[model samples]
Target: MALNIKQTAVAGTMESSDVMVTVKPAEGQGLVIHLQSNVLTTFGDQIRATVQEVFSDFGIRDAEVFLVDKGAIDCVIRARVQAAICRASGEGFNWKGEDK
Candidate 1:
């Protein structure tokens, strides 16, 4: 069920308690994740794991994912990832902001 990314797309904002997620088409490479966050020392592993799980759930095996975290929680990470994927794939999706 892996879907190819059509183009670069971004979701969310670099605001407090939120995350900005970007997805782009990658050739040959599969799911490269780059994450930056203030809480990386304490939460890096968890955040990375969560993002990877979200990608797996959406069947996204080939893409370059870049995310900037501003103290976002797991659910926010999931929502932003989903929204970015939808936008990159040209699917209609609206992220209702924080509460996701």
Candidate 2:
């Protein structure tokens, strides 16, 4: 299994990045993360690492993550990833441009 994400950059405010993850129907445990980062010091790297951390719990080894980053802090990165993961898992949160 491999963890891969087909990411795309959207043309708009990069203040807060968004992820649109879709897991393959056949897969059992997978991680799909779409992450973005603003022009900050190691922010992108931090977001990626944080996302991976979240997936680590599920032992996710397959996924396609997309990221659209806005100017956000590390905490925001973690929160967004968690939110997406929650939504993906049917935990039922909200991703309609709302707060985490």
Candidate 3:
């Protein structure tokens, strides 16, 4: 199925070990990300890249991503993004799995 985000959705928390990802629908355009973080000067590019990669992996071409980070690592970033996408798109994370 061509999974797609239907409306605005949010995932993750604003705690120390998490991040908040807000995704909203967009037209025929690419992903536009607005990142807010304490380490923007240090890890900004990496964070944006990771988010973009995850979105690409899920075949997401159009959306607006607003990420409020709280010192989350790459893995956490991936998880949060995936969760937000699933919540927004209403698709589960069993697309590329072997078993439950």
Candidate 4:
């Protein structure tokens, strides 16, 4: 089932090796992402693809995502996105399902 976002939520930090992500409900926006990263010239597409993959995993189709990157790796980015999504949707992540 798709996650139904109920409110805006944020995760992560602006630390040198971290990334901050904000998630908000957008009924018809269809996964809008606003990203700010100093490394955009080189890693923009990869970063966006990582975020998109997380959204797809959670079955999210509509939402507004604001991300501020600080040279974080793909795993960190995925974790932050998932955390924000879970908080916004007021749901706990299904850890068991992911192990399969």
Candidate 5:
């Protein structure tokens, strides 16, 4: 079972996500991603797919992401994750990809 995720409201055209995941103390640390979004405009699948793709680029596994959206595009989500990952790892958002 998983914990219920809540929304974190903010003003902007951003598609943000709150990710929480754990690494095993031992071996075989698998990946886990929990995504929740209020971006109810037939764009949930696209957003989810984009997030997964971005995560792969950063070599991040075993992370849960909860997203609450309000009319946001896939680009926004990708941007948010890029920013969050940069902040998380104390690096930069080296995002080099075509606009979705």
Candidate 6:
């Protein structure tokens, strides 16, 4: 289920309690996450873990992710990351399947 990312994509917004996620193809670069969040000191690990989980779920092994968080919860982060990844990969999600 490895995704062949064709272009960069973004999802979500910068509103309060929302997060903006950008996914880009990085052919040989493995997964690289650049995150900026106000709660970095308190929830950085959790946020990164969420993003990593999404990447793993999509079987994405090479890509660069940029995330700007505005206090978004776990679900929001997961959705945004998933959306961005789908857009970048030009793939449709299987909402009722194992992707969740």
For candidate 3, give the lDDT of residue 53.
93
lDDT assessment of candidate 2: 0.50
Error of 3 at 80 (Å): 0.4
lDDT of each: 0.88, 0.50, 0.89, 0.94, 0.50, 0.92
Candidate 6 RMSD computed on C-alpha atoms after optimal superposition onto the true structure? 1.4
Clashes of 2: 15
Model 6 C-alpha lDDT per residue in residues 3-29, reported as the tens digit of each score: 877899999999999999999999989
What is the TM-score of each predicted model, taking all chains together?
Answer: 0.88, 0.52, 0.91, 0.96, 0.57, 0.95
Q: lDDT per residue, candidate 1, 1-100, as tens digits?
A: 4566899999999999999999999978988999999999999999999989987877778899999999999989988998899889887654443246
In candidate 3 the C-alpha lDDT for residue 17 amounts to 63
Instruction: Please report the candidate that would top lDDT against the real structure.
Output: 4
lDDT of candidate 5 over 65-88, digit per residue (tens): 555565556666666665555554
Query: Ranking by TM-score, best first?
Result: 4, 6, 3, 1, 5, 2
**Relative to the unseen true structure, what is the C-alpha lDDT of residue 35 in candidate 2, on a scale of 0 to 100?**
56
Task: Name every residue pair that clashes in candidate 6.
Answer: none
Q: Which stretches of candidate 5 lie over 4 Å from their true place?
A: 1-29, 95-100
Q: Comparing 4 and 6 by lDDT, which wins?
A: 4
Each candidate's clash count: 0, 15, 0, 0, 1, 0
What C-alpha root-mean-square deviation, in Å, does candidate 3 show against the real structure?
2.1
> For candidate 2, lDDT tens digit of each residue in 1-100?
2223223212233443433333322254455555544553566667677767755644456555565666655666556555555544544434563443
The deviation in Å at residue 71 for candidate 5 is 1.9
- Candidate 3 stretches with Cα past 4 Å from truth are 95-100
Q: Return the clash pairs for model 1, or none.
A: none
Judge candidate 6 against the unseen true structure and give its global Cα lDDT, from 0 to 1.
Answer: 0.92
Per-residue lDDT of 1-100 in model 4, one digit per residue for the tens? 6889889999999999899999999998899999999788899899999999999999999999999999999899999999999999999988897779
